[model samples]
Target: MADTEEMFLRAKHRTFSGLTEGSCPSTRSCGATAERLAERLAERLTEWLTEWLAEQQAERLTERLGERQAEQLTEWLAERLAEWLAERLAEWLTERLAERLAEWLTERLAEPLRDPEEAERQWTGPFCFIQAADPQLGLMKAWRIGDAVGGGDEWEEEVALTKQAVAGVNQLRPRPRFMVLCGDLVHAMPGTEFREAQERDLKEALSGTDPSIPLVFVSGNHDLDQVPTPSTVEQYCRAWGDDYFSFWVGGVLCLVLNSQLYFNGSACPQQKEAQEAWLEAQLSRASSAEPKPKHILVFQHIPLYVKSPDEQDEYFNLPQEARQSLMERFKRAGVTAVFSGHYHRNAGGCQDGLDMVVTSAIGCQLGDDTHGVRLVAVTADAVVHRYFSLEQLGQRGVNEELRKMLQAC
Candidate 1:
C-alpha cells in the first residue's frame, strides 16, 4: 500500500512540478492523483509557453517598442496563453478522470447478478408507483437535528430505509410494479468514497426486493457538479442502469428528465433538444398505440413550484426556460402531474396545468417535517398520493429528529 501510494504521489508531483507550487498530500489518494496530473500538465504547458513568450519578447525587443509598451504586450500575450493552456488542462483532466472512472466502474458493476429480464416474468399489477427521495447513503450520521440522535455510522441506515420502502411496495398486498427515487442518493459529492458507498447501499437496498420493480431515478443537482457534463450523466446511467429513462406505468406515459438540465448552459442544448425530440416521439407513439395513455407524468429532482424559505430565491423552483419547455412538452404530451424534491420539506400543489408535488426528503427533514416516502396511486381517472413516514412505521428516533427540525423550520 505504501509503495502504491508513493507511485501515485510521484506521478502527481512529477506531472505538475512547475505550475501548482504546492505539496501533494499522501493521505488522499484521489486528490494526490488530481494534483499530480494538474502539476505535470501545467509544468509542460508553462515551459512551452515560456519558450514561445521568449521568442515573442525577443522579436519585440529587437523592434523599437518602448518599455511600457513591451511590458503590456508581454503581459497580454502571457494572459491569453495561460488562459488557453488552463482551459485545455481542465478539459484534459475532466476527460481523463471521467474515462478512467467510467471504465473502472463499469467493470466493477458488471459483477454477475440475477438478470432483470428473468425477474419480470412473475410481475403482475395494476402497476402502482412507489415515490421516495433523499436516501443519503454516506451521510446518515449528518442528519441529526438538535437533541435527537439521528446519525448512524454504518451505511445500513440508508440501505435499511430503502429496503423497508421497497418492502412496502412489495407488500402492498397487491404490490406496486414500479418505484421512483426522487433524488439525492448520496448526501455528499460523487467522489470515490461516495460512489463506493452508493454502490454498497444500492446493492443492500435492492437486495431481496422484487428485482422486477422498475426504478426510475432522476438526478438531483447534487448527483453531479453544478455544471453537469455528459460524463456525469454517463456515471449516473452506468450506476443505475437505464433507470433514468422514461417508460409507461399502467396507462400513464411517464417522462423522467434528468433535473441537472437546469444548470450548466453549455451542456443544455443537446440534452434539451434530445429530450424534446424523444418526448415528441413517445407522445406520437402513445397517441397512435392501440391503447393511448390517459395521463402523462413527469419526474424531476427539483420542484417546478415550491414555497420558498426566502421569497427572493423562490425556495422550491425550477429553471424558468427549462421549466417552461418542460411544461409545454408535458402539456403537449398530456401530462397530469410532476413529482419532485430538494426542499426536504413537503408542500406541493398545482402549478400551471400540472399538479406539482414537492416530496419530503427521506434522509432528513426540516421543522416538524416527516422522514417519509410519498406513495402515489394513479389510474385512468385520477391521481392519489400519501406520505408514508418511516417514523409512522415505528422508526421513532428518525421521526423525533425530523420533528425537532421541522419545529425549528
Candidate 2:
C-alpha cells in the first residue's frame, strides 16, 4: 500500500510539473495530462497488485491452487486493478483541473473599474435568485453503478439532498425572489417508470418550499430523450409547462431556453425556427422595454463554453456553431449573465462582457464537488454569487443519512 501510494504521488507530481513547465494553456491540455497520468497510475497499480497477490499466494494459498491457476488469478486481479485505478485517477484529475480552470477564470474576469460612472452603470436590482441544476432524481438507480457496491437504492440520497436544498432555500433570511432549475430535473429517459418517479420526488420536494418563491424549469438532454423528439418535448411541456419562456423577477429579464433543441438531431425544423424567432423577439422587447430591465439573465441547461467561449465542443457545452451564434446574440442584446447546469460542477467564465455561470448539481455530485446550489445576489453595482454546499447550510444530517445508507448497502 505504501509503495502504491508513493508511486501515485510521484506520478502526480511529475504530471503537474510537466504540464506547468510546458505551459499547457487550457483545461483541454490538462485533460490530456490526466489521461496520461491515468495510464501511468494504472500500470503502477497493476504491478503492485500482481506482487501483492503473488506474495499472498506463496504465504498461504500455495496448497489450494496450482502454479498455472495462481498465475491466471494474479493476472485477472491485476487487470481489474488497472481498470479501476485508471477510472479513479481520471476522475480525481478531472476534478483538480476543473478547480484550477475555475481559478484561472476568476483571475481573468476580475475587472476593476477606474471610473465611478462606469461602475454605476452596471448597477442591478436589490433582489436575488437561486440557480440549481440537474437534480437527476433517478440517475443513481438508472445508472446502476452503485448496485455493485450494495447501493442500488442510493437514489434516495438524491431525494434527501434535494429536499434539504429546498428547505435551505426557504430558510434564507432574505429569501430568493425565485429559483431556476436549469434542467435535467429527472435522469430516466422519457416514458420510463424511473422518470415518472423522479418527477414525483422533485415535485414533492419543491412543494415543501415557500409558496411565494417562484420556480422556473428548463429542459435538459436527460429530462427529454438523449436526442429530443417532438413527443418528448410535448411530454416535458405537459409536465413542466413551457420549456421556453420569459418572465420578470425584480427588474431582471429572465429568459429560459429549451437547450435540448440546440443539439437534438431529431428535432423538427419548426421547433428550431420557433425558438429562434421567440428568442429574437424577447431580446428585442427587453432591449426596448420601458425602464429597461436592469439586467438580462439567460438560463439554460448546457453552457456555451466551459472555460473559454472559444473552447472546442465537449459534452458539457453547447455545439460550436450554435455556441458562437448564441454568444453573438447575447452580446448584441447585452445579456449580463447566463447560468447553466449540465456539467454537474461549478465553473464560471466571462466572455465578451457576459458571464457564463455553470452551477454545481443539487442532487448527485459528478466530480469531487459537493451537492449545492448557487445563491446569486444582483446588487446595485455588481452581480455577486456564491455556492452553498449542503453541509454549510445546516444540512449535514443529509450527509450523515447518506453515509449510513451507503454503509448499510
Candidate 3:
C-alpha cells in the first residue's frame, strides 16, 4: 500500500510538471502557426511575383528607360506588391478560417433561433421556456481534478449531463416554448484542445431536442474571450448566432445579451458601442410599440449582481458602473427579470422591481448546489421561475406547478 501511494504521487507530480514544461499551449501555438505559415506563403509569393513582373515588363521598361533604371523600378515594384499581397492574404485567411469553423458549428448545431422576423413576436398568452447555462462541455472532470485548464482532454460527464438536461426538458407535460442556454456552451476556450470535439458532441446531444422547441443561445465569457476581440466576436457569430438578439414568445419580449461586451469591451469598443446602440433601439421600440409586450425579460451569461445591485464587483458579476447603468436602463424599460448563469451557483435578488436571477450551471458546480437548470414560466402579470435538479425536472410535482403557471395566463 505504501509503494502504491508513492507511485501515484509521483505520477501526479509528473503530470503537473509536464503541463508547465510542455510545448507551447495549443491556444498560443495555433496563432503562431498561422503567422509562420503566412510568412512562408508571402516569401514564396514574392519570388513568383518578381519573376513574373521581370519577364513581362522587362522589354517594355528597357524600351522606355535605361536598363539599370528599369531593373531598379522592377525590384521596387515587386517588393511593394509582395508586401501588399501578404497583408491582404493574411487578413483573408484569418476571416475565412473563422468563417469555415463557424459554418461547421452551425452545420452541426442546427439552431435557427437567430431570426426574430421569422418567428412570433406578438403577445399571445402565458407560456414557459427553459433558461439554463454553462453546459460547458468539458468542465466537470477538469474541476474534479483541480485542473480546470489543460485538463479537459475528456468531457464524457458533460455530455451525459447535457443529454440528461435535454431529456428532462423534453419530457415536460407542457413543453417549454423554447430553451435558451445562457452561455459557456463548452469549457474549452475558443482556441484550446477538445474545443471542437466538445462543441460537436454538444451539438449532437442537443440534436435530440424536439423540433417544436427552438434553442436560443447567449454568448458567455468562455464562449469567446474573457475580453473578446472583433475577431472572436465575429467567429462566435458565425458559429453560434448573433451575440445579442431579441425575440418574442407568448407576448413577452426576450433579449439575449452578450455580457462579454459589458464585462470587458477594451479589445472591441466598436462592437460594444454597436450593441449599446442596438439595445437602446430595441428597448425603446419594444416599450413604446403598439400593444406593448406582456413583459420584458433579459437573458445573459453573467448576472448584474449575484445578490444585490449594490454588491461589490467580482468575477462572477458585472462591474458596478456598467451594472448600474444597464440595470437602470432595464428597470426604466420595464425589464422584469434578468436571467443569467456564470457563478456556477444560484444567487441573485430582486432590486426594487427588477429581479437579477442567477441560475446554477448544468455541467459543473462551484458550490453546494446540485447540477440543474432553471424553468421560467411567463404569465401576463409576472415572470415566475424556479430551479430544479435534472432528476426533479420531470417530476409530477414540477409538471403540475408549470401547468398551473401556464394556466394562469
Candidate 4:
C-alpha cells in the first residue's frame, strides 16, 4: 500500500511539475526566470510592432502626398499650356486678319474690277464648241498601236503629244468659246496619286492657254474612285470649280451629267428618272424662250451605243427605253447632237435627226492604236466633225503600236 501510494505521488508530481513549470510557481527560481524572459519578449515585440506600424503609416502618407502632388502638377501644366496656345493662336489670327485687311484696302484703292471692253475686236465669227473627252492624264501608257505591226508602248511619247494638243487648241486663231471634257480627268480617284500626276500634267498643259476659255466637265465613272461616294464627286467638282457646271456658250444649250449614276444600282433608276425630268424642263424652257437655243448639246461619260460585235459586253451602254426616250425628247426639242465617251473607241449613230458623237479614249487603247479626240465645227448652216489625231497636230509619229491601232480604227 505504501509503495503504491509513493508511486501515485511520483506520477502526480510528474504531471503537476509540468503544469507548474508552464505557469511558473511564485516561490521557484523558474517563476522569476520566466517573468524576466516574458518582460524581455514583451519589450522586443513592442519595439518591433511600433517600428513596423510607423513605417506603414509613413509610406501610406508619402504615397498619398505624391499622388496629390502629381495631380496638382498635371493640372497646372495643362492650364499653362492651354493658355499659351490660346494666346498664340489669337495673335496669329489677328496678324493674318490685319494683313488681309491691308491687302483688301490696297486693292480697293488701286485695282478695282475692270469694265467691259466696248472696243470691237475683229469678230472671228462664233466658232463651234469642241467636244473633247477622256484626256486620261495620269495613264501610264496613253498611246496607240497598229493591228498588224507588233510595236513598243510609247507612254512617254504621248506626254509631248498631250502638250501639243493643248497648244493646238490654244492656237486655234479664235478658240472655241467653250470646251467639254466627257470625263476621266484624273486616272483614278480625285485625291489619289493618279490625281496628283493629273494635276501636274494639267497645269503644264494649260500653262500658257487663255484663261477666258471656258471648260465644262461631264463626270466619268473614273473621275471619282470606283466606289460611288459623294465626297469623291464633291472633291472633283470643287477642284474643277464652275467648269463642272452646265451653261450655254452661244445658242447651244448644254447639259453635263454625272455618268456614275449607272453604277449606283436601284438608286440609279430613280436618279435617271429625275435627270430625265430635269432635262425635259430645261428643254422646254430653252425651246420656248425668244432667241431659242438653236441646238441642245448633251455631254456625258458613257455612250448610249457602241455598235460592238458583242453588244452585251458594252460597258454601261444606255438601256433601250432610256435611249429611246432621250432621243425622242431631244428630237422634239430640235436637239442637234450628243457627245459622249467610255467606249474607248469612236462610234457615231444618228437616229431621229440627232447626231451621236462618241469620242475616242485619251487613255491607252485595247487594240494596237493611236488615241485621239474630235474637233467639231458647228454653225447655223452645218455641223462638221474632224477627228484630230495627235500625230497630225504635232507633226510627229505616235507609238508604232498606237499608230497601227489608229489605222485599224
lDDT of all predictions = 0.59, 0.70, 0.78, 0.54
- Candidate 2, residue 386: Cα displacement in angstroms equals 1.0
Q: What local lDDT score does residue 336 receive in model 1, on the 0 to 100 scale?
A: 82
Clashing residue pairs, candidate 2? 123-380
Error of 3 at 186 (Å): 0.4
Candidates by TM-score, descending order: 3, 2, 1, 4
Q: What are the clash counts of all predictions, listed in order? A: 11, 1, 1, 17
Global CA lDDT computed for model 4 = 0.54
For this target, which candidate reaches the highest lDDT against the unseen true structure? 3
lDDT of 4 by residue, 306-353 (tens): 663124534557656556666677788887877888766777677766
lDDT of 3 at 210: 66
**How high a TM-score does candidate 3 get?**
0.70
Q: Go through the candidates in order and give the C-alpha RMSD of each one to the true structure.
A: 24.3, 27.0, 19.8, 35.7
User: In angstroms, how far off is 334's CA in candidate 3?
Assistant: 0.5
lDDT string for model 3 (178-230, tens) is 78899999888887778788877887787777655667778899888798999
